[model samples]
Target: MSATVADEGTAPAGTRTEAVQALRVPVSRSYRFELVKLVSQWRIRLLMLVCWLVPGLFVAAVSLQSTLPTDTLFGRWMHASGWAGPLVVLGFAGSWALPLLTSVVAGDVFAAEDRLGTWRHLLVAVRSPRRIFAAKALAGLTVILAMVAGLVASSAVGGLLSVGDQPLVGLDGHPLASSDAAGHVLLAWLCVLAPTLALAGIGLLGSVVLGRSPIGLLLPALLAVAMQLAQMLPLPVALRLALPGYAFIAWNGLFAAPAQLGELLIAVAVSLAWAVAATVSAYLLFVRRDFTNATDDGLGRRALWVGLLPPVGLLALGFGAVAAAAPSTTGSGITQAKVERSVATSFAHLYRLQTEQLHRPAVTEAQLRTTATCDRSDGQVDPTGPGNDWRCVVTWHLPGAAAPGNAVYQLDVASDGRIEADGDGPKEVNGYFLVRSAHADAPNPLWQFDGDVELLPTSPKG
Candidate 1:
């Protein structure tokens, strides 16, 4: 009787409960379980396989086509240099592929549980909503990272192997050695991580809020398309800068002579802002969600209304910030002097390349003493902001020539500071569409080339 009483006293209240909690699975195990679940899905396996193989296949297709896809940023150089392939693909992927890649898995992860009516079972087994959310998010992120890795790696290797390893031409027309180009390519890919994560965050929020697999999977891509369209519109420069979509192409600055960090920095900021807001909102909703009604239609109407706050807030916040900052940024828009300097600099470098390709005497950028004057075709009074109808006349002195030579180029300048110039000329000089190089006929780098100008406030001297 004494022993029995002593044992009963030692076994305090909730002793069995404590043991049960201890025996419950940790978050790490849950994360692994989520990963296994993802891998088992046929769609996820297909996505991974596509990511690994598409780049190489695309490279091969490019090689086979008689005409290059010059519409893309680096498309014209894809066959001539291996470094261009990955860049062209990057340009394409940023618009739609990246958003779809992120949303497919993330948007479906949570909603799939709801779709299959497994939420109750999962919660009972996991015992903590926080743990389940963390595990699912972590799993989705891991899959995203893997997909990104597979695409980048495959693209790099495919470009180098399929297109012979040749020197990459910088936006300034200066040649980049293979090693240096490799580094820039890697950094450019690294710069995209934050933007992709932001999209993933958006997808996660959609999954939790919509509680439907199809809608969740589609929300991110649809949002991406809408943002892209917004960017194409004639929005204010400050407003456009605030959108995370621009970050997709901001990596172009990395290839500039003096890497343009201003826009790239803005991109990082906006992307992180979106990512944090979306992710935090999703987390709050997921934890507070009522899973008692685990059926597909069980998510309450109130939660749906609350779930909309993040996106609406984000847009209002972005627009409000830009509107607030607009007054201070009025004078900082793109100017004629900036365009003149950029065109002069790019033309000088590209002219040198043309000369070398044609077996003419070599000339340096300094030796060219290039200068440019530009005006808008629309006869706009300002003629300073982004427009597609800009025209420029570039003049330069050649070695042993008494008089200076001039070339005319039509410029289409984008809101994001990218300038594409097409030369108009009498074929003898820098105007030929194609040039005969020592190896073979190649697209003339001087005929049509791209350049970038900084979007920051113009200095007094500029």
Candidate 2:
């Protein structure tokens, strides 16, 4: 009896060791099997093909279009400098196509097994539901990553081949040197993928909760579109925090002058949160739910609502926040006028200094005038010599005041180079003049003119 008991104990130990060894093998083996099954599906193969071919087609179409002028919208959009090239394209795809593609794989991952009546067999043969869920999630994510990689690679390749290497101009009209811009474009594409992972998780959750292949595949895409539309509503600032769209806007950092890291970090965090929550919840629901009754509708209503609510609430809250934070337009127009006047006055002073130093003739009078409130002109004697001639005209608008009437001033310089300032204006108004140099294409050399001006009050009360 002792020998028989020892034999049984040894046998169980050996079996347990073998089980542990099997578990120790790389988890990827299970994922690989899932991947093989996924690739074999007709829908997946079609999606892969579409992802590759569509970008090529778009590149070809864009290449055929005539080159646009620098200022033209199409030119700016296609050029490297414009956000249109990489960030815009990637954002557009992430917001719509990536989610749709991920949903296709995730939605069908588990649901297809049920639809084909393979779930029962799968459960029996698969050792653990957790392991199966892990493998399936891995497979779905792998597919998404592959799709994103293909699209990014093809688009970059196509863009390079079609648009020869050129310094990309930035949104602020500054040129981004060729070498640096290329690196930024690549980085931007990678950052865009961060958000799509959450989209994959969302689709995965939908697949588990709905247990219907079609619902799983389409719901995430629909949800993305719905969120996008809802984010447009006038909402409070805090609510925007919940929007997926906000994550997308974070991509703007990649194109910023110094590169905005703060917003990008926030987006990365939010995206990861969405992915983890969706995936964990999906796993929990799948493990706890009964699969024994194949005839019973796959998911209960409660599970569906649980899966759907978080993202929906996030969307609504985001929309409300954005609307609330928008600027109120109480006195925007008046404020704008004041700001414009300040900028114009600064420009006038700078122009006057440059012309006086560069030109031979000295300015005699400078006159500033406005039709509605105040108008004035003035001239100054040439300190250097009597022969030098100088004259100027200045137009200005008061703070929070409408633009005044048209005012003109002319100057006559005598043979000796002395400027005799004579213009239609009061002596006090014409005492000092603002002078500006003539444009390169002007009719005469040393052309002088009055700078346009606006008088702004020193304080808001004025």
Candidate 3:
């Protein structure tokens, strides 16, 4: 019953032929073979180790700091709650770390065989190019999943141990207890997997066509950086939503009260489509390559130079197509209506913060009954585009006030749905850059407030 390869080799000629035939039977076990090879690599082992260690080191560094990274979401609360640390790390990792890590193994998985001069022998052992490609892709995906797991586990444990479990402050300025914050963090991490898989597909395609480990590893990572840069510019909302990179920031929607789902839904759909298209393209190219002549010098210098053009050309073409389809007047998706909703909500929240500092009666966002009217460029143009010239008057009904009070805020709205608002205020209420508290002068929560609106229109909620 135990038929080893050695036993088959020692069998009679008829039995040896039968054993060979049996081995050729379509048994897809190449996944195991690829996994073994992948795990044995020093780089992969090191990557896993880094994933586990980096969070602890990062938490320790943050714990020793006096100031917070306020620019990053949840950064301002890192000292106030342990739960905030992981969210800050998640933001940083999505912007820079995750894309590069995804490229490392995915970009090299197939090309490494070409470098080792093992293609022919591998072909003989597997007997199916399709199986080999499938195996490699699956193994690469497995490694990505593993890396994400290690990071989430390490980050949560490190933050909890270093800072202790406390309530987290949401992007909407509401507090989330540790129990609910844990769920939101976990979901946010899960949302990251979609775009990350899309990046892996790009890396795999690079590995298949370029046959150079360095080029494969670097190209996807470079593209990710380029996307980040593009996000900062005034691009069309439809185009930005089509990009997989936007999904990284889309996770922030989960932490907002009355969670913004429009952008998140679009991001998941676009990212998955990219993953499927890239993977299929890579598979077709891999199966059709002439392995007999496939030396370590995969594409010649000229071909290698040519290989770089596709990714660039595809990016350009995609942008052009999306831009053409979007309306010139309403492309940015930042309308006066959406801005008014966001401004009113943000003012209500910051007003409560100011009230707390003054030791006045506590106010709830709902009880404030806040509303905003915004205009663009003094109403010279349509109040629907992103610009620094938007001005808003926010009115709120506070308890015991005979008439509603209003405050002016100058807003700089970005194409990416972020709004930077400065209170041009009655100093007694909105205060200046700093407000004196019992302890010391703290940054005025009312002076400058930041908020993000969903690109796609959704029903406004308090």
Candidate 4:
């Protein structure tokens, strides 16, 4: 039997086994062709341009500024993330621009075929609706990913160049160690891509349902705006779950101190689920729908409008509810003044203790006018009150043991009664001072001291 099988294998080339072996062929390399088509599209090129250029321009302008407040949370975040500022700027954009950018590509992908009446030609040439659907979907995903990459890279480079490599300080007013912050910034950038994919899927679904490039493009953008509006409502948790724009805000947790992974995971899962559903719906509809020509069916148009209007109406209702429920702030200024007064009173007591501790007998109350402005020989005068002069100014002279001149001691009090001092002689303590008010209605003692004081060159001279 073995010898007979061997003989059959070695049989003439025209035999069935030999013919079967020869029939096997390699799979067609259509994915590469699809990618080429995607890359060649003008819309894809425009996305790439915006991703790179917009970030670069914004970073360049910011970098040229003579000063940037290092104290602010956002400013510190920008400084630490380096070029990530422009990319972070995308969070602001994703609220609108990203949705529009995504829609531009997604909405046009399938709708363009219907508009140009090329659906029939593509279907016949491709010979597989499944492959055609996958190609278009992948092309849209590829464009989005490419734009994300460009935006991240450009923003990183631009920020690093424009803003120096500073350690990131977090929103909670704590510093992020350099290595830790860089990783977080990169991860945050990547996390944003998840929602972008979901946005793309929405646009693709719109394209499939609308069968017109204009509607497909505008639909996703409009939906994003609608979702944003809806998110403002005190809606049921389940209803909020249905909206996509919520994921963008959820991304901010990536920069949190403990790093909110649970919210991020939920966002990722929700976005992925939405993407899958939209892609599946688009695929099934594109494959089954009759697209013999560019002409729109009334039924298809009605479906598109019906699908679009519900979300829009919900959003409008949400906006109305929010507008009506917003708090009135007409009396806020008076409320703010009362709060400020409470703070001021609490700060006065601590200032009195600090001033009494620094006093010297050589620094006479008359020469050391706790109220007079001390004109340093260097031309710097210590102002005495909070209104740019000094909140509380205390001046005293230090008598020198061996020197011809007495050293000056000047303490300028801020409106908050925090004391700052600068002088010719060494002071034991320097920098900001804190004060607590002894009582609510009691006068601030530090406020009683004059701005100027003179110390005797010697105690005998005084």
Candidate 5:
């Protein structure tokens, strides 16, 4: 990582500049230093322990469950296959758990020097804040990547040992042979890694801005919390489509027969974009700022405040603008047939999954026979492609039940073609719970099983 000093005596002014730059020391050296520090830190040591141990424990606990948990994307497969265990843990990891994992190191790296009042001493030894920031950020990212790897490996191993490597089912309920399932599960874990890096970048930005450990940690965690909350809010589908974390759903599509390649690309692009932007901004701030806390002039204080607020403020304004400008009911090019077909196909696929949990006689997709007519609203709106204002009167029959009357589904479709549907169907339209199978002992798998299915009609008919 060391750079050789340039010979300035026989060289031009540019060479002198190169020499000066070369004398600045390598960022890799800083990275190595940070890595050593991370390994030595007691809290980090504890975090590593938790990361490896928790997955094994979680998988073990899930193994004891008696019934399929049909709620999550891969919950039913939890006990059915070891592959499902990591996917399930991935769902939980995206929450507060992930932020804490990345932020703990990122948020503390830069800010710790300021908090400990060791900037003067550290700078004397460390050359520049640029090198320090690079090393710390690299170390944080490395730690997070390791944690992600550990969790995936441990969860998969734990599930295999405890649950047995049964045939893993895709999100669409298509059965994947045990051999092919391992690759898909690994890919799913890889897909989840994007947001982890993005969160780390955010943590770095927060740490540099706050100049303290706790606040640095808290800011990124709070942002993560806020994003999760925003995802749950009843907002315009188009606006939600722009959200950074919304890309997480794209991973669910990976478990499908034909993994949603378009969604996966978009998700990775958006998440990586966020990560890059945050990392660059953090690096710029860390490199340029006067961490000595000495104001060269009256404006230095003002400049600091301006620097800190503008990025955050602009981000906030951007999100607000999109939400405000978007229509409550965005237009779509979808037709009645398209809507009906997607709902019918997805419903039958999911409901059959539900019925399996309920221990009912097997039913075919043809048997469900979903009949529905969709209306875009009373305003003569054309439901051509995607819209949040569409409603469908769906009638489908199940075995051993009275001829049920019509059920209604109110649908909201995102610009990305993801659907958020609410309806008066028995249980929930999507992510509905099914009664556990008879003679199951431990926790039922299908209990309160809610699922996610992002719909972009596979076949559209006129």
Candidate 6:
């Protein structure tokens, strides 16, 4: 039988009490209605299809490329296993893709009613505005979870079918057995859930306040991008943590053998906090709102300030909470081991790029026999925290040179994993580095200048 509240005058007192009690049940029919309405939409179906298809296609296409797309997390493993395909998409989606997909439904849930000129009629038909709000929120959450499921299934299945279930590779150059790697893939997807939920709440807020599709859809996604750019700035560490964007990539740690989760946990906390705050604020704004005409009334100066204040206030709360509760150090922090890895890996990668530019294919990090040892100026420094006075001595192969050459770098390593180095050597001459010696017929070795090289992070780019 259908579960619903009884009309006050129509039902006997006993029946009314029973109905009220029944209405307290966790899964309300009203919420089911909202889910049906949302999932049945044609665009939602198309989005699910795209979500399922894009990752598999991306993996297959990348497998054919001559070089890996090292800039993205799991990109290096496109050729590794079908299991890794899902993770690659997760990394790719960290920026705008995932947020935009999430916003597609969230941004539309409430504002869409305004767009259709049905807010008044819908509100009038529903007995309680609170119930309607609950239904809508539940429906959006359901869609987000469903989309994530589809992505996971499609990527996993499609990758397994296309590439086969091979062993997976970790970010630290270690390999995992296929059976064990499978669990981490699911966990990796779950890690992204925190940020995805946060974006949904932001979308719901945009819907409640703006009551317009464009603002509701684009604003939250744009804000997410802005948060990332904020992280890139040379701001204080606590300030960066306050913005939810910094934590989006914390899942990259899950792929590690032991799984470094301290940073990941902080990011999850901040993102969940944002999600709860945004959803609650959106609900409050929605219940208090006076729904008028779709085109003429609330679209203008009427709704702007009312709708704008909640999000701004929410951001302020996030910033303040992070400042007060989160540590001054947001990331893993700079360490000697990390510095050595970054310098060696980046130097190798940049050297490869340099050699490619010089038309030398034989030069590789392995053939170059690259090795590095790094130390902070203060020999007894803590393994973590920012340090400007880092030095790394590196030795590598240089063709036609009597012996291997060395580069001494005075490095400045930031907490965010960006490295800058000043070097004095034959390899790095006037900010230029040699890649290869001249062929038998040529006169001089080819070199790549500092401006020509890009310093990549030791961490995944997600």
In order, what lDDT does every prediction score?
Answer: 0.81, 0.55, 0.79, 0.53, 0.65, 0.66
Instruction: Give each prediction's root-mean-square deviation over alpha carbons.
Output: 3.9, 15.3, 4.9, 17.3, 6.9, 8.6
Backbone collisions counted per model: 0, 46, 0, 23, 20, 0
Deviation from native of the Cα of residue 344 in model 3, angstroms: 1.0
Residues 249-326 of candidate 3 have per-residue lDDT tens digits of 898888778888767876876777677767877777777778878554355554444454554554555556545654
- TM-score, prediction 2: 0.63
Best by TM-score: 1
Which residue pairs collide in model 1, if any? none
The candidate scoring highest on lDDT is: 1
Q: lDDT by residue for model 6 over 267-293, one digit each (tens)? A: 787788778878887777777766664
* Candidates 1 and 3, the one with greater TM-score: 1
Q: Give the C-alpha miss distance for residue 398 in model 5, angstroms.
A: 12
Q: Name the regions of candidate 2 deviating beyond 4 angstroms.
A: 1-26, 67-75, 79-84, 309-462
lDDT value, residue 172 of candidate 6: 44
Which scores higher on lDDT, 3 or 6?
3
Clashing pairs in 3: none
lDDT score, residue 379, model 6? Answer: 69
lDDT tens readout by residue for model 1, 1-462? 356446555777687456556757899999999999999999999999998999778876785677888777877777778888888878877887789988898888888887788987888678898999999999999999998888788787788887778888887677789889888888888888878988999888889888874777798898889888876666666676677777897888888888887778878788888888888888898888778864643255776676677667776677577657554343335788889989998888888878877788888888899999899984665768788889998999988999999888889888767888988874665578888766889678878888887766657645
Q: Tell me the tens digit of each residue's lDDT in model 2 across 1-462.
A: 356446556777888576545544345776887899999989899989877767645654565465423222223346433323444457568667777887788777888877777777766556567778899999988888888777776666666666656666433223467787778777777776666777777887888887764767687788778767654443333443455544655554554454546546655666676777788888888887787887643577888878877766655644454345432211111222332332234223423333344463432213322221111223243211112233233455333446642233353322111122233453223323323345332111112221211111224432
Better candidate number, 1 or 4, judged by TM-score: 1
Per-model TM-score on C-alpha atoms: 0.91, 0.63, 0.83, 0.58, 0.72, 0.70
Displacement of residue 233 (Cα, Å) in model 5 is 1.3
lDDT of 5 by residue, 284-308 (tens): 7667776567422112444346445
Instruction: Report residue 31 deviation for candidate 5 (angstroms).
Output: 1.5
* TM-score, structure 3 vs. true: 0.83
- Model 4: runs farther than 4 Å from truth? 1-29, 66-87, 236-238, 293-462
